[model samples]
Target: MAGLAGTGLSGAGAVGMALPAPPAGPPAQVGGLRVCERGDTTYLLDRSGRVRSLTYARLVPDNRLWVRQSYDRAGRLTGLSVSWSGFAGRLLDVRGSFDARGRLVRESGFRARGVTTPLGSYLRAVPRGLTC
Candidate 1:
């Protein structure tokens, strides 16, 4: 049986899974940030030229997810926020503050309009290690 790497599905017989390729065109420099667009998602680079954050939208469910990240001068993520929308305009928002080594130091959650906390699913969708 084949196993997937980094997806936590090891030994589950999953195989040949890969993330979609980024947009084919070159990234454009806007102000101090580099912007790359892939379909409905836009990735933003921090001052250190790292992919610091992104925002994506889904049409099928008519929802959107946005990630905000802050990095110190050395390019290590120090703060992160992952937020998503639900039906009826509800929202689930979570924040995480990380230490110098990227270990989460504090976590906070907020809800508006009685939305379900799909925080786990949203975090899983994120590119791992950037979560709270």
Candidate 2:
């Protein structure tokens, strides 16, 4: 995905959402990137202090979904993916792309059927330094 070009993620993702505060340990620095952990969630910040990626667990109804967000070099969100732990391992639920202006462009996957996309929610919840 275009947004993933400089972030090392090969899949689609983008944007940042409010996550719980980190527990106690300091953020870890790796190769100029800062990794912050809060419970089952992790946020990766680039050298310029932009969110590069976010991986977090979300509860939906009776299922627990793992969500990932990927951003471009400018810290603009581009794509998102959701998955869930299954008997066969992690099963993808939905994957969507966002236009540069943060509109949901395309989404697919069986679990995505009939569900309102969360693009607006994520855009509204984007954290301080990140852009949707």
Candidate 3:
């Protein structure tokens, strides 16, 4: 499927069938992370209005992800991960997390979907991730 390939994930069937795309309306309100579209980029903004990460919402029909960026509290890009949503076996993951000093310390989950992240990822992270 076009949506599956959009994630940069090889082997569409490898990950599993992609779920039909969620209706693209306004970007979903995800806790302390506010989403906004600037050109083709979808950015996840921290409460202070700094860019915490940038994500792509390409292929609206069955949205997928390219590369995901995560920032430290100091506004440094700390980690990267591939998140996918809508697949029959879609994964919710953090990929990695770093300390305020920007050092990778602990890791939680990973599925390797490479598509847009499912809500589980945010639900799991933002509760503790968002500070200030």
**What lDDT score belongs to each candidate, Candidate 1 first?**
0.62, 0.68, 0.58
How much is the lDDT of residue 22 in candidate 1? 77
Error of 1 at 116 (Å): 8.0
Give one digit per residue, the lDDT tens place, for model 3 in 53-75: 76654445555545576776567
- Clashes within 3 Å, all models in order: 0, 6, 4
All predictions: root-mean-square deviation over Cα? 14.2, 14.5, 13.8
List candidate 3 stretches off by more than 4 Å.
1-28, 57-65, 82-132
Q: Pairs clashing in candidate 2?
A: 13-70, 13-79, 14-70, 14-78, 14-79, 15-77
- Give per-model TM-scores: 0.50, 0.56, 0.38
**Superposed model 2: Cα runs more than 4 Å off:** 1-26, 29-32, 59-62, 85-92, 112-124, 129-132
lDDT of 2 by residue, 1-132 (tens): 776788765563345534688787666786777987656667788877788788887675656667788888887778887776454444457777888887789987655334555544433243675422
Alpha-carbon runs more than 4 Å astray in model 1: 1-27, 39-41, 46-48, 112-132
**Candidate 1, residue 45: lDDT:** 68
Candidate 3 Cα deviation (angstroms), residue 81: 1.8
Looking at model 3, the pairs that clash are: 19-86, 83-115, 84-115, 85-116
Q: Give the TM-score ranking, best first.
A: 2, 1, 3
Instruction: Identify the candidate with maximal lDDT.
Output: 2
Better of 1 and 3 by TM-score: 1
